[model samples]
Target: MELSPSAHVDTFCRDRLPPFDLWPQLHFDLPELRYPERLNCAAALLDDAVARWGADRPCLLTPTDSWTYGDLLRRANQVARVLTEDFAVRPGNRVLLRGPNNPWLVAAWFGVMKAGCVAVTTMPLLRAVELAQLCEISLPAVAVCDHRYLEELQVADAPDMRIVAYGGGAPDDLAARCAAKEATFQNVDTAADDVALIGFTSGTTGRPKATLHFHRDVLANADTFSRHVLKPRPDDVFTGTPPLAFTFGLGGLVVFPLHAGAASLLLEQATPDQLADHVADHGVTVLFTAPTAYRAIMAAGKADRLAKLRRCASAGEALPAQVWEDFRTATGLRIIDGIGATEMLHVFISAADDDIRPGSTGRPVPGYRARVVDEAGEPVPDGEPGLLAVTGPTGCRYLDDPRQETYVKEGWNITGDTYVRDADGYFWYVARSDDMIVSSGYNIAGPEVEKALVVHPHVEDCAVVGVPDERRGMIVKAYVVLKPGLTGGVTTVKELQDHVKRTIAPYKYPRAIEFVADLPRTSNGKLQRAELRSRAVGAAG
Candidate 1:
């Protein structure tokens, strides 16, 4: 398919796209995977849902209100009208969206796509510094933000950008302006391969890299993982803890549900306790959350509240075997473990139901292909740990960045994760290629030790890292968060050490243990291992 001449106007994202030969091989082997050249994701996921299942079907639910498929379509149309008429948003203009997960926020996202504009959704909790960096990179012509987050957007360094605030009483508020606009809109005719969103990676290790996704990429995920792995039903109710800004949330909470004609329960802020409660109260059938959240829910003795769920998914970090086993024991549900990246849009490797293996991230999603390769990019033998390389319907396309070479090489997405494929083809995660620790003559994956420690009844949370040591060059160190009443004394440390020795290879046990009240984490609940390593080095010095 060729690019539509009328697809875009600004041309920044399109012009910056890495050359075609540099793109990872794209496959569309499945019959359902075929997409039309002229496509609009919002139209396919939202308006089409309304057409297929009536407008009155519930699509989005929250504590105080709900939006039917028809309601969301009307609101999205109004938002598109406001963008075109009030803000003068042109085709291909980048539109920055700032807000929590809400009906309005989802509507704004659809509005951007319907208008042929790029949606750069930023986390609601981000401060001016982060917002300024995004504004500098995407150069959005306008922003649709929640009233609560307007201060940060106003202070962000985007002099040419106009701001429209929603959920406020101000006369110029987006809702009020949208109210005066028509409830119907003609969506722009965009090419299937036209960039629709710029998803920025969560910069836990370094500066955030913006990943571009074509309109087809959005629907491709729903057709692949949501169809084959999740197999959600139209009556299913989905809920999760990830923010709308994260692609995981965007896929799990928005695209997957609407694609399947299911309803989603959106939450502005959800702790593990709150998430469990909502599952019980809303009769949520499908759950999407991180491993940390599952552990916290189990620790809080609230696992019983998730009895209503038929399926649970774990991602954003490696799902330790111990965590997976404990969750299944407590809830009788084997949490589906998947390995996905912001670069790839969603889970390219996952297993469902009887196919799930406790410690292994499953084979590639049907439309994708993956392999474990050595440093030279040659395929490694089974049982040998090496870099994970993947190619599929979706792959990394960084936005005008020099790091493009580092992400895409030789027609494959070189995910920085290290893995070893078993003789059966299940991929066992070793560690992040960069996070692998070499102590003495042994190579240790810190997550293996952390997993061994986390299963102990007294351990609430833990992180394992390599600490500098003159004699051994580097030694395993564990930073642990104990249960409230548990004392972080010598006895507890020895118990954890002994637990690791029994769980995996004895040589991988942490040589030193430090009890901390909490481990550093990103806003999305991913462990900041780099921060933990830095602190350990400082303490040693």
Candidate 2:
């Protein structure tokens, strides 16, 4: 599918053209893009789906019930009316949504968009402190939460935010209120460039950064990944484990499926076992999940249930060659691994069926350009490891964050990932640029060590980080999670360290090892190396 010259400009305008025509020229330019523009994602995508696919087609499928395209539209409209008439939610208001992945959460997201309020979806695992911090940063006017997790949002320090509880049989009260409310609400006149959502990064290191996306960005993933990568059929059913708050989940579980007029199975609790069951029960054709979950499901011997899935996508971390091979051997389907960030909106690099290589993240998708660059921002030769830089339809646009200068350099969003492009143009994953460990002046990628450790029979999960040392400057430290029933002590640690020494470079072996029941992970399931690094520094001190 070759995009015409005007196609680029037309798609840009259509995707981003806000209701009020704010910052019209900014939409066309690159670096000069700014916020406070008019935008509403519900109008652009969900409403379009209702128009084309009609309301009778299944749009949201869960363990409890299924919602057709029309049902979702009506519920979202009812939600919009409830927010506007009852809760007093208005344009430019920031509304925080706290809940597990379910049909209500999806409805609330579109309703928030329909009401012209920015949606701030958070991970359900966050406690009061994390929730309070996000509320402080966003200063949200209202919060819609699942009654099951309401206690987590009841932090005393949170600024007087209004709360509306969903589920838990509030049906008699809230349902009556929803029925009395108007089912049709007009879209607020918003510019296509206005901030539609404030997606907070999983703060593995320091404070989480809120990456801003406009209405156009919500659909950009569909045009890029849905069109090029998965190519879902209208009859395909989609499901995943990533939280809807994370762009990874939102793209695969919500946007891609909705855009293609397919059904999505949204689970409040998506364990590997639950995922396998859903695929079998709902005939889910497309699966989106992390590499860790894939490994876990393979270990659990549930690969047979996933055979019905036609397309599978892996992200949130590197996909190990062994995991890829094991999944394919069991399910007879190649898992397409891609690398995406909140900044880029969705996966910028991925492989379709025929283009996949076991260990390599395929070349950049259409409408995007990716290259490896050196310290000075010069392109590195093919087969040389360097920082990955990307420029395309959807790039990093932070919300008045100082880190913008660091991430968006020279019109390209320089993802923190380090990679090497082979002569064949396949991009191989290295460690995060900040995660590169320097031991005795040798730069070793932590992912390489972690991948080696995962292949061990006794190791279930592991994270490799650098600890400060006086002599070596920084020494490799490994925090490992043993498989169930495996003992963790000096003997096992030594054996795992020896295993790493044999797998890759001898010097990359962990000088220090700690065994735990579980390793820290971000909301999206990425390893929290920054947290591990902090612990390592504290231990060294």
Judged by lDDT, which candidate is best? Answer: 1
lDDT of 2 by residue, 373-472 (tens): 9877899999889999987767675554567777766666789999999998899999899989998999999999998998999988899999988999
**What's the TM for model 2?**
0.91
Clashing pairs in 1: none
User: Model 2: residues >4 Å from true position, as ranges?
Assistant: 1-39, 171-174
TM-score of each: 0.97, 0.91
| Whole-model lDDT per candidate | 0.91, 0.81
Kindly give the stretch of ten consecutive residues in candidate 2 with the minimal lDDT sum: 1-10
Model 1, residue 170: C-alpha shift (Å): 1.7
Clashes of 2: 8
Cα lDDT for residue 358, candidate 2: 95
Runs of candidate 1 with Cα error greater than 4 angstroms are 1-6
- The all-Cα superposition gives candidate 1 an RMSD in Å to the true structure of 1.5
